[model samples]
Target: MIFDKLKKFDIVFDSPEMDCPPVFSSGDVVSGKVVLELSAESKVESLKLHAEGFAKVHWTESRSAGSSTAYTQNYSDEVEYLNRREVLLQADNGELTVLSAGRHEYPFSFQLPEETLVTSFEGKHGSIRYWVKVKLHRPWATVKKIKKEFTVIEPIDINTPSLLAPQAGTKEKMARTWYRSCGQVSITAKIDRKGYTPGEVIPVFAEFDNSTSRSVVPKAYITQTQTFIARGTMKQKRAVVATLCGDIVGGNRRETWHGRAIKIPPVGPSILQCRIIKVEYMLRVCVDVPGTSKLSLEFPLVMGTIPLHPFGSRTSSVSSQYSVNIEWLRMAIPEQPEPPPDYSSVVSEEEAVQNSTEVQPEEDLSGVLQRSLMAYVQEFRLRPPPVYSEVDPNPQPFAMRPRCMTC
Candidate 1:
């Protein structure tokens, strides 16, 4: 009689309670063994093993403010965390055939590349840990994983600062890791005069600045409208309006417009006649870097004022000044006209001239000459009547009569 008895085994990690290295410093070799209990007299096909681990770091940047009132004080803080490091172990497996097994054991080992590891264990430590694990696999048997944790002790460093006192200007540069790039841009508007006079041009100018360490290209634009003001339903006032819009590329740049100066129309002091600065709209500016994962940042993209100037204020005065965060602005594609159709049919010289004549009306030089001649003939035919002269028919022989009287 032949008996086809199946082989059974139990897999266990050597150190189930012990933790792996807290931080896999560069060139650290992680080791573990698989403990197997073969059932009484059985045959096994094969055994497999796998080991994996990784190192990672994450942090955030934020803004904070504090205010003190007569009764109480308050402080506010905002935090933005972004992952900085990631190194994953490649999956590796080893297989072995078992001819006849009563009991067997397998060991596994692996190494983490030193160059890829970020050794930030000393300066900013509070409980940042990277984990590693060893896994054992057997043919037709359950797989077992062994997880270990360890403390990452920093090598003594005189320059290292305590966790509570992080040194200034400290930064980490890691490739393939996510980074939060920040930049500050300002939007300013200025009028030629403190106030604007009705019916006069008010010069306007704007400037943008990138204050953050990260370089950024910003969008900028400008707009202006008329606004009106009235006092107690009595007198009305008019003011010139202006605004800046569009993306401002290269943080340090200025857009100047001599046309911001607008002439106020002459009108009586009435609410209906009063004109006020109106709608001022602009697109939000933002840093557009391709390939890099875009981290979301909360910042103002637009800032400006309407009726920028108060009514009944001095003439030739500034209307309003506004600044917005680039993030808040929306992106838009400028409207573009479609291109003309390509010429598929070739035309001969004669056809080209014919088409040109057909496209343009022929001048009627002969008709113009005829009209002019007709006008001239009409003038001559309708000339004013010649003045009639009364002739002195009795211009008699006054000399003969005078001579006779003298005799």
Candidate 2:
């Protein structure tokens, strides 16, 4: 009977362009309409609209006591960026309003706060979201709610002098096992700039020198780290957004990457403004040696909303549609925690060697569908043998196959 009486109820957002999504930033005005359709006359109590934006992080960990007892602890935190409410329809002088309409529309508008806001983000254990909810209360019926979400993109300009600066780092790791010194491997790498946007290419130039007795494989990854802080403790989840690998270098051989490009996929802008949740990006160039820890070079990266100009001018470049859709951007992250090696802390003690294999990048990367399919292929790999491949004395660069190791 309720379904028969209520024909339709929906909330729709207005966009500047017909096909584009409604994307806003700090201090922006968001306007939308609520539609209702009724087949017969109905009595209404009150209608309210609420808009809110905040970052939330929650996860649970299990621990054991001295014996068989078990206990669970929760790590959670919240940081509010916005809270606004407005009344659309209400009772007049404590009297219920009776409506005899076939179709009704209620328009609402809310201006975001002037303070800076973090970009919209979704992660495994945490998320930063903005949404508007409508609540309808009736005399004898339970309250009904309708919610719609939006995307907020705070601009990060890569044209600034700070972001335009080049980043370079060099790190070396000794290859040793059980008090035996096989040798050492060191990497020197640099990126053209520290800031990049979606669809842009990062030119990686690096040199890997291996003096070990066994062969080594060189690789690069664009990693995204999601950090959640609560009660003075922090938890981090990583996802490999993009990957590129080089050829295998034989023992006592050298390897180099001359502007090997790693394209940035469509993802949310870096969320450095949020306190409870932080989204960071890093470019890692690593060496996978045998029977020892690998050497790596890391550089901080800023994913921005603005793209670099073709002629290096101040002219603005437009962002594509994929960047604004929060849902699509969430899909950019892998479902599983398919991250690369934790090069953050290399094997200082030469713990255990990790084996890796090669994965072929798709030939046609023209559309999102193909890129998503490529993502699945690159993340899953078979366990490698003692070495990735036989000692190719040549140690030539492998251009087509860019892989992410499963180990």
lDDT to native, each model = 0.26, 0.68
- The CA lDDT at 202 in model 1 is 28
TM per candidate: 0.22, 0.77
lDDT tens readout by residue for model 1, 1-407: 00233233333333324441122334665555444444444433334443333222222323345464233322222111111221122233433434343445555555555443322211110112334444444455554445544322222111112211211111112112145444434333333222222222323222334444444342222111112112211111111112122343443333222223222221111111112111111111123222232211111111111222333322223333322211111111112232111111112234334433221122222221112111000000111222212222433332222221101
Q: Model 2: per-residue lDDT, tens digit, 65-174?
A: 98889999998989998899998988769778777759988999989999898887666567788999998777778787899888777877777788877777788888
Q: Which stretches of candidate 1 lie over 4 Å from their true place?
A: 1-24, 42-46, 55-96, 99-103, 116-156, 159-407
Instruction: Give the clash total for candidate 1.
Output: 42
